[model samples]
Target: MDEQTATEAMDNFTAIWNTYTLEGEVVHWLACSLYAACRKGSTPTVGKGLMEGNCVSLTRILRSSKLSLIQFFSKMRKWADMSNLSQDFRLRMDRLERNFEVSTVIFRKFEPIFMDMFQNPQGAEPPRQPRSRKHRRLPCHISDVFKFCWTLFVYTKGLPPLYRADGHVSSDEPPPCVLERLCELHDGLVVEAKGIKQHYFKPYIQKLFQKQILKGHEELLTEMLDPQNFIDNNKAINREYEEYVLTVGDFDERVFLGADADEEIGTPRKIIQEMTTSQTAAQSQLQQHVEKSGSLAPSTPLTGRVYLKEKDLLVTPVSSATQSVGRLQSMVAGLRTAPSDHLMQIFKSCSRDPTESILARVKTLGQTFKEHYTNDSDDTPGAHIEILYYKILENVIVQETKRLHGRDMSVLLEQDIFHCSLMACCLEVVLFSY
Candidate 1:
């Protein structure tokens, strides 16, 4: 193989070896030897051949090692299978690759902000004194390392020749044990780093919430729950809805146009104009009524309203339109006042017994995982379970922080929660894998 192909082959081999082998040093040496053999066009024996090779060749090159070559190659073969990689890793890699270009640009644009956040966890100001060596050594600021490893893991996973274009595992691909091993090692390292981060960053995270960096607790909470922001968000959502309506309108128009190709195009234009005029007249009447009553009348029509049904297009009735408007207004009003009430309830609950509420939430999530995913053979339950656990834990932490500090502490809570959950998950995986 040429240099590029040899390098690629080595990468693939490392990923497989890492995925399967627990002993890093032994696997590393074995993989290097195998890669070198492959580079020189001497293929490594795999599967049955590896297992049964001793009977055929007593002088086999790898037989001198303390570890059986047969067992090593057999394990390598199993791990080399593209399907052996975890579903979560595969999906993450796929997503990363799909957005690789966009993510690169976005990361570059926000690089300074990211660096600042990492270097100065306090956000607003630097610490007066330098942190202790132990604190400085924490992996809390190594999010980028995890990200890079995840990407590499995905890339290496794909490098296995067994991966088919249609996503089926091919039996004929050459096993590259070294690359697989390396990828697995990277995965373990990243997981361990995250655990370190979670352990060390908890106190700093709490301090940040206590400090209330950018704004006071109430101000931050109010800003987060502001109805005005909700309204602005709705405006963007409404634009998407309008676009959808226009698309559907065009589709309907095409259907009608197709049925009567001989009909003048101007006919549809005239019909649209008439509809617009009627809508405008109704709006004018509704405005006059609202002006007289100093509020919307019960029967006032909303302007430019159209509803698409399964088989037909319908104009909204004045009373129905008015009711819709009232419902929306009520919802918006409820949104404006709901946050404070919810926060107060959470505060009360936290004051009574914060741990109880947290435990209850965790229990609920566990039950949900069992009920929803335990019997679903198509889904991998571990990733989903981890996600649910993380979300619940984060919410609990956020609520607890807000209750104690009397403000939204989500800005700092988020980073801390992520690291903590990740560490917990890594520990869980280690326990289960053994």
Candidate 2:
């Protein structure tokens, strides 16, 4: 292979191989190919015969080709043993590589921010003024080694656990491991809010309410119950987070879009607004009321507001949205770790195929694997084949979630379309159970 080809192959190989446990057969093939290439003092001509070499021979060949065979082998060994390398070492290796490894990709992501900082040194966010480090890059410091190490740590540690003994994920799991961290964050927020309430309101309220003129805590009540205060405090954070999610979704679309696709597509915000309006309109029609004469009144419609206020409720809108997200995240977490007994029940309740069932799918998947992939089969239950189908199911869940912008547009609908789309593929008619 030429320099370009070699670099490309290594990039593709390291991108996955660095993170995953490669099968023995795959490792042998890679080893043999590297060995043969080393023997020839150039890129090895990979073929069936060259891919079945001994591990020792393969290691020698890799050393001959890359000159960093020791480190590479160490990484491979850790992967085989299902262990992790030092975060610092991993970051160093990733950056030293002349290809797009995870560290390099992260650095590239921060490029725009770096350029902005360089242009206007006095900006509001001047690249966070990297913490003073001992070993900075030459000539005013190109990069921070510690920062890179931390970034690598975050990417690997924060990344969702992709491998299980079964080598599979479930239908209802979140895409990134970030979701779990987000859950932790949600809990932290709740704790903080509770602290704020206890510290600021509890003591002050007792004294304020004790005043006879106030009459039964009404003086302190207005300070707490006013909807305007909730909006005023949380509006900025809510707007910023909403904008960030929209931007991320847009980025995902841009990455996935075909080259021929138009660049001027409608923004997610516009699409979501339109959908929300339509859903609100539909809900209004359902809640429409008639006067005592039994004739429908033109002005009487169901609660058409995005948020309905209860007479005695006490929660900020942002707090409610946060709780909703936490619930959704928990639902995902439950689906991941639950056993077959509970798993089957969850799927049965959600799927359109109440009879065929996830249990049925599990069994059918086994048969299909035995029939077509018998030689490749392992002793594990619903191994690789079943996992592949489960991944597809998970992807469908993501699509449906995105379609509704993480809100149940059909929450107003009597039937559970969101549930059906995420879990039920076979049901022809989903009855609204509002």
Maximum-lDDT candidate: 1
Name the candidate that leads on TM-score.
2
- Model 2 ranges off by over 4 Å: 1-346, 349-355, 375-377, 380-382, 405-434
What is candidate 1's lDDT per residue for 294-398, written digit by digit as tens?
766355475323553345535567655656545534433323211244444554444343434444544454456557545533234433434434444456656
Range of the 10 consecutive residues with the lowest summed lDDT in candidate 1: 248-257
lDDT of 2 at 428: 14
The local distance difference test score of each candidate is 0.38, 0.36
Clashing pairs in 2: 352-424, 414-432, 414-433, 414-434, 415-432
Error of 2 at 77 (Å): 52
